[model samples]
Target: MAEKSGKAFDFRLFKRLISYTQPYRFTFYFVAFAAIMLSIFGVLRPYLLQQVIDKTIIPKDGGLLVYFISLMVGVLFLEVISQFLFIYFANWLGQQVILDLRIKLFRHMLGFKKQYYDKSAVGRLVTRAVSDIETIASIFSQGLFMIISDLLKMLVILGYMFYQSWQLTLLVLVILPLIVYATRVFQKKMKAAFEEVRTQVSNLNSFVQERITGMKIVQLFTREETEYTNFKEINEKHKKGWIKTVWYNSIFFPIAEMSSSVTIGLIVWFGGLKAAQGDVITLGVVVAFIELSQMLFRPLRQIADKFNTLQMGMVAANRVFAVLDTEAIIENKGAINLEKVRGDIDFDDVRFSYLEGEEVLKGISLSVKAGETVAIVGATGAGKSTIINLLSRFYEIDSGTISIDKTDIKTVSLPSLRSHIAVVLQDVFLFADTILNNITLNNPEITEEQVQAAAKEIGIHDFIMSLPEGYHYNVKERGVMLSSGQRQLISFLRAYVTNPGILVLDEATSSIDSHSEQLIQDATDKITKGRTSIVIAHRLATIKNADKIIVMDQGTIVEQGNHNELLKISDGYYRNLYEVQFAEV
Candidate 1:
């Protein structure tokens, strides 16, 4: 999908982001006040030098000179104290805002439906949550403070310089338009460059994440050389991006320096002529003008540099807001709480497609009575898993109604509806936590005895107990620390622990060995004794005892009956699948 685009920075997004900082407005205001005072104090230092030259030293008044020098020291001390407090509070406020924003972003992302993850990249999400947030924090903590201080200091110095001598100030002001024009040109170029840099960085991050996640496959295929070349290309692109950024910065600084130099030279020549003529211009005033000239250009140069940084920050902000603004189409709108469901499932003419106009489930209707065990068997891509997904409301049907206990799933609150269903898919995912935790994942309140009972019922308790840490053994990512069969058993235990009214086993035994499959089947029979169960599998033997067998083909039901009835109809899809499995055996 093409990403949402607009101006480089969205004002509404910024407004929302700033709202988070409302709690720290007091601190920000105090910091700004301190910064203004410090700038005032800083401008006064050069004026004090001018005073010592004009009113004390030039007049041979050593006592007055000492007093002014002591006063300068006192002003310097005050500036230092103010700066310390400003930095302390600004840093504190920035960190707090970042912390709150990170947490809020995380919660929002978590609340998004699975389809959102299906469309978004993990690296891009991580970049927004971590890198982009840090960039914004820097802008808030350092950039905002510096901009205020520099602009205020420049304004004060310019006002005083013009007040003292309008002619010299006007000479400097003549180049103001040129400076602004140049800054705009540079800003535009830098913004474009930074946008490209941000894109390249995101690509590099995605590449690293992909390679790391598939490292085992890469090594197994002995494609290290090819992967290395790919990485080198991405790295080279990143290097070129940074080089372009540096090149722009390098050129901008020289232009600013040249502008400042020319302004100072003009003042020296013009101001000196006026002083020589005794044209109401003292040596003290001329010296102060020179100091003020430096002060003015210093901030102008700083502003140019900061503008570059701000442009980079704007690029990051654009990416961050893109994520924040994504609207979840499927969300609970009203309080339609489902309680004590009896697990009667109905799919009334359900039709769905991941992409528009390409239906994957077409006009399919099925009703599973309360506590009934239904097995759906189909060829690959025959909509068996899609039916399971629809029943769980993972994806909304394009056309039709799905309900549990007569209430349309859409009308029910998602959390409450999903809380009563337990699903175990072919590919089990286990966190890097203890074995006990993985088994009791759905029920953190489950006791140790309950965990042990569930494991024993699944016939995996002996194997678990053999480990050094027993139930406490850590399951690595995807349960790599355990065998495939052991992982499948743990998944079964997890589902059983939930005590769900509706159980879904989507190829649950497909990953296990025949012996483990038998154990899981035995446990499944026990678990489904009182709960409604929907088993989607390719193995016909596994569902021989199902109360009903549904055979589907190309998103539609082709045949459905009891095991004996399907066998009697030799042309039925279920009988053919049974023959194929028997032939393999």
Candidate 2:
């Protein structure tokens, strides 16, 4: 399990969760009414039994006995109907609330900056959305409702007991303090057990997800025995948590049962003596007292059980709230619209570091004209990709000014700024969707003809058309159904469909075959003709034709000029890179 930060659970999350039920207010109200009615019926049952013994059975009245028996049957029928209605409404409400919260959380996660994903694992997020939400739903639909109804019934039972005979009621009430103390102690133990269980469950989930995702790596390394042993260790930890919870629960139930038994046994002894001593109390009254004694503890037992469930729910809620409380690093508040951009971009003394004192881009200053192709070439970890990320505003600079057409990017809305730029990454990600939908990405306003045009322009249309389903071919998850080159071609087409003012190709053709690479280069040249372009390339041949080539080494520009100008330099980075590529060719 991930280490908890020890932050208090955000109460505001509860308020937000309750707000989801606003749409189903009428249904929830009806469910609550049913639960109340059911509790009232539960309390009335013992009184009816008392009356049956006193009025009908003792007096030997057959008609009255028949009527009382019929009444009991009617009450049972009503109870069943009410139970069904309550269950239906509560389950519906719980499902709706879960759906609503998951949607909101997912949308919020989507808007979060890349940094959040860089630090958080996918397995943890999935657990929050799925298992945690279900746990909270169980709390609301069953645990919370049962607790409220049982408490109400207990109060009514106590009031009636006191009304019947204060002496007997006083003796019973003496055990109340003990019950309360035991409950408090049990609650603390249960909560600790639940927290451990929740942690173990999360760890188990993480292990399963990791094993599935890295199955190939595991198999290739021949670590099946080691992996199985690791899994067993984690599984045992989860089992231990469950075992601790069960142990506490097992001890609690017997103690509660024993306490109730002792109380009832004493009540019978005292009541029996009073009846035999010729007191006003009759046999029927004593029988009713015994029934009421059992009734009183039944709800108390339910309350105990509910408390255990509530503890589990609260632990799950804490985890869910952790995810919901994480404020996105990037947010857009104002409406700063850019109608038509000339694509002039400038980076003024940009300095950035992922962590403090570890600069990635060191006071880098550069500019690109409205329609120039600028290629940035560098070795691994030399900040080539960081420049593109800064321009795209994926990460905010620690101290710098990035502007588009003389307007500071920070002043404009993030979505508005990014909407005008399109990026083609080296590791292309295509959704498990139809080819046309993957290309257009469900942009309803984008026409089929436009999609076809983009695919053709990227030189992937012929390949797509030759498929069994043509444009409608389904690309499996992560484009696993397609070859690496095919997936890259589709990604290129996707960017081309956007036709943004600025294009960023970050080693876009690095993973493709030579034939596909040539085709993509042609398509890239055509697309970048009149747009501001930033090309980060390892293969020098791809960027040799750029209007400007900036060579970087160790977060600073080593040289900057056109291809031939850099090649003429005595011992420049660009010249050295070009020599290596040509020598290999």
Candidate 3:
């Protein structure tokens, strides 16, 4: 979920956002310059109006009137151009910053350890990377730049008003405290409401993404009505979150409008009294004061709303910064050498746990020589998969070292280590792409011809050719267009194309029918040739031909030997499991 910090105007967060603009520093500074120019133009316009009424129109100076009016029109043209630059450049800077931020955020996520994603939801991460960053863009679009321009306008208006008549200025100052108090209250309440709104949005996204991904389970169990009911509950929370922000907006804007009107009334009543008494305050002076007051306080009223945008951006920045700040990769702080591996793997007394005090692998020591096919067999939760996970360094071991070719795995760079190994999981994930693209995965080095050659070597090239578009076939999202067996064969060719030194097939045949399983088995045998392979499977027949078999019970290996050697001990866990799967063998 998106976490919110308490500070509404976090300078630390503001600085972090500003730092991203370094690449486009000139554009950012130019936008600021535009804002300043807008203030200058805005403040001068009202003063020119006062001049027109008192100097040109009053003394019947028809000849001078045209010149002064022309000057005012020229000023108006420049103001329009300045406004155009402000709006256009401000939004341009915002778009550019978000483009870089989204790219940086994604690159950061790619380096994180698997553990970070294991406990995270796709929807929450998507919300942060997508929508929250959009909200952050408002920091420039409707927030930081506009706020600076408006505040400057307010300052200039007040400066000229004080110079005109100090008495009316004093009267205006009397109601200033009340408006300030109301704005402060509005901002505080709005900050909390906005934070809640962001949180509910993340929750709603998480729920919908997960439910949709696993819609198979929901439909299989006939839970559509029930799931929809649950979704309505989450949706209600999301609606209420927005309603709270709207409720605060409803209460505050009208108060600001009312205060602006009251200030105008006070200015008119007081200036009229002064004119009747024959003071130096003229009609032009009173009208100019009124105009100046509106300029001063109109921005004052809009400042609270813009500040709401600022607070939301800061809150989103805090969330985004938290992800960037996490040092969760368990980084490879050792050598970064891409050495040619012989695939002689050794696990020496390795122990690990996904959570505290719940060890998954308990001091398991095992070794596999180069080019040997090893199989690990275990019941559910027997820590069979953990061995491969630790070997791959997906999860760091708590107490031992896993080494390949006599070098500690942790000492090697992750890309250098993972590049030499290929994993084919039970659920083969294929992208929404053509068969050739999925096989090559857009790697220029692995060409279409190379993929065709590898598929032929693995004996599934004929299967691909049998399809309507032979190699150019579009396997829709998650390879739903292909059968389970076809996807497994594609996974085989994918791994084989890389020519990895080590191959890991985790339950690759678990979900296949007997026919597809046989095809996968043949493909697996061809691909694993001359490579160090570790196979985890429930089918006892698949590992019967392996050089060695490791049987795990809980978190430790209970038996290790060939099929006949293990079957000789009828009382062992291996024999018990083998007998149930291959009773006819």
The best candidate by lDDT is 3
Structural similarity to truth (TM-score) of each candidate: 0.94, 0.94, 0.97
Which 10 residues in a row give candidate 1 its minimum summed lDDT?
1-10
Q: What is the per-residue lDDT of model 1 for residues 402-443, given as tens digits with 9 covering 90 to 100?
A: 888998888888788888999998998999999988887746
Q: Which candidate is the best by TM-score?
A: 3
Per-residue error (Å), model 3, residue 501: 0.4
- Give the per-residue lDDT digits (tens) of candidate 2, residues 1-585: 222433223345455556778999998788788878887887677777877987998899989999989998999899889888888888788888878878877887888778788888778788888898788887667776777778877887788888888878877777767777776677778778888998888888888898987888999999899999999999999999999989987887787888788878877888778878877665666777777777777778777778777667667777876777787567566366787778999989999998789998899999999999999998999999988887777887899899999888888888788889999999988888988998889998788899998777767789999997988999878788899888888888888898899999999989999988988998998999999999988998888789999989989988999999999999877888888889998
Better of 2 and 3 by TM-score: 3
Write down the lDDT of every candidate, Cα atoms only: 0.83, 0.83, 0.87
The whole-model C-alpha lDDT of candidate 1 against the native structure comes to: 0.83
lDDT score for residue 123 of model 3: 95
Q: Which residue runs of candidate 3 sit more than 4 Å off their true CA positions?
A: 1-4
Report the alpha-carbon TM-score of model 3 versus the true structure. 0.97
